[model samples]
Target: MASIQDEIKQTRPFPSPSAEAVVALMRTADMVRRSVASVVEPAGITPQQYNVLRILRGAGEAGLPTLEIAERMIEETPGITRLLDRLESKGLVTRVRCDKDRRRVWCRITTQGLELLRQLDAPLQKADEAALQALGNHDLEQLIELLDKARDVYRRIS
Candidate 1:
């Protein structure tokens, strides 16, 4: 019988032969995303939405500007208006026009949002555990370090 690697096609041949690492990250991130999303989606929020709320929770009840929140996100979203729109519509989050500057909008996670996030906590933990269960602690740490290093590869280019 073929080994496990023989049955899967995760990486195609790369001209430079070094693109395998990129392929692995893409595949692993994709798998983790799906697994994580499954756990969080039932809470009525996408990963991005949850992330925004989490950031707000950490930053305190005062909230953060939309552009600032976008800067802190893992991936670049299409600005923050639509995201806030969806979250607000769900009553999970709220947007307030800054009194000092009418053009500045700050986003605050509502009590409902916090409650939903609280409900999602245990399940999210389980989902993360399930996703990383195959790896040993040392291996997981190494993988995390590698991904972080890769992310910082071209600070100037990005």
Candidate 2:
């Protein structure tokens, strides 16, 4: 394993342990994102689109409101409307205005979206597994717990 300093070719050390950890986390996240993008982008959709499709698929027949979908995204994105527009144009999803709440829009995964996710399912799983292949089961669990603990700072503020 390469040190963060070596991987980034940093001549100067991070000022603090927190700074080093933050940089390392961001770097690792970018690597994982690229790995996922390799799988999903070749299929014609970015990872974010894949995320939205999966969220809607999990919502089932009743579906979920547009805002709710945004809340559920793995990566927080401000342009969810544009994301939906792209997915809608691709014929992968549909949006219907709620009858009772004129301002609320319900989004649902189309049959095509479901089918696309189905095709990518196995490959996505493999990609995810390969990303963490270096970690044993116990280490993986500890990493998850540590990540959760790290996020407690944001949770407290929010």
Candidate 3:
């Protein structure tokens, strides 16, 4: 397998180690995301939809407000309204107005959505394992720690 530099066919060296690491991280992330998409696409849902379903499942019967769901998503999704619209049309989710606060809408996963998630549980596990297989258990743990630290630094800066 080619290194990220070789894969990208870059002739010049990166200006700094930080630049190279950033590019490599982004490329690796993109590849992993595409791999995940392949597993999800067959189920007739995008990865973002799968994420929403999983979040709703975690919320249980009480569900969660739409904005709360947006806040909990793995990535910041600006098109949440459109995403929810698609899920609602597919019968995967329902939007209900909060009783006490008529202005707030709660999003709940439908039976079909929960069933879909149950069906995906195994495949998603397999996909995640396969995606990270190159990294042994120790390496994976270390990578997680390093990534967490990087995120902490980002949070502090922001």
Candidate 4:
């Protein structure tokens, strides 16, 4: 495995280990994201769109409010409305105003969205597995734990 410094072609030493770790984590995340995108994009939806569809599918027939979907997203996006608009235009989702609360809009995955997700499911799983295949289960578990701990600290400070 190439060290982060070598991969990034950094001749000078990092000022701190934390900075190095942060960069490494970011680089790895981008790599994995691209890998996932390769499997998803050809199906006509970006990864973010796929994420929204997955969330709505999990929400079941009742669906959820638009704000709730935003809160549940893996990557915080400021243009969720635009994201929904694109999906809606593609016939993958539908949004309707709440009867009781006129201001609240509920979003749901359509049959097409669910079908797309179903088609991608196995391929996405395979892509994810391949991305982490170099790591054993124990290493993956430890990595997850460390990431969770780091995120917990971030949440507390943020």
Among residues 3 or more apart in sequence or in different chains, the pairs in candidate 1 whose N, CA or C atoms overlap within 3 Å are none
lDDT of each: 0.85, 0.95, 0.93, 0.94
Q: Rank the candidates by TM-score, best first.
A: 4, 2, 3, 1
| Segments in model 2 whose C-alpha atoms lie over 4 Å from true places | 1-12
Model 3 — which ten-residue stretch has the worst lDDT? 5-14
| Candidate 2 C-alpha error for residue 140, in Å | 0.5
**How far in Å is the alpha carbon of 42 misplaced in model 4?**
0.2
Q: Write the per-residue lDDT of candidate 2 for residues 1-158, one digit (tens) a residue.
A: 67985757666678678999999999999999999999999899999999999999999998899989999998898999999999999999999999999999999999999999999999999999999999999999999999999988887997
Using lDDT as the measure, name the better of candidate 3 and candidate 4. 4
Mind giving the per-residue lDDT tens digits that candidate 4 earns over 101-148? 999999999999899999999999999999999999999999999999
Predicted model with the maximum lDDT? 2
Model 1 misplacement above 4 A: 1-12
Q: TM-score: which candidate is best? A: 4
Candidate 3, residues 1-158: lDDT per residue as tens digits? 76986756676678678999999999999988998899998999999999999999999998998889999999999889899999999999999998999989999999999999999999999999999999999999999999999899898886
Which model is ahead, 1 or 4, in terms of lDDT? 4
Superposition TM-score, candidate 3 onto the true structure: 0.91
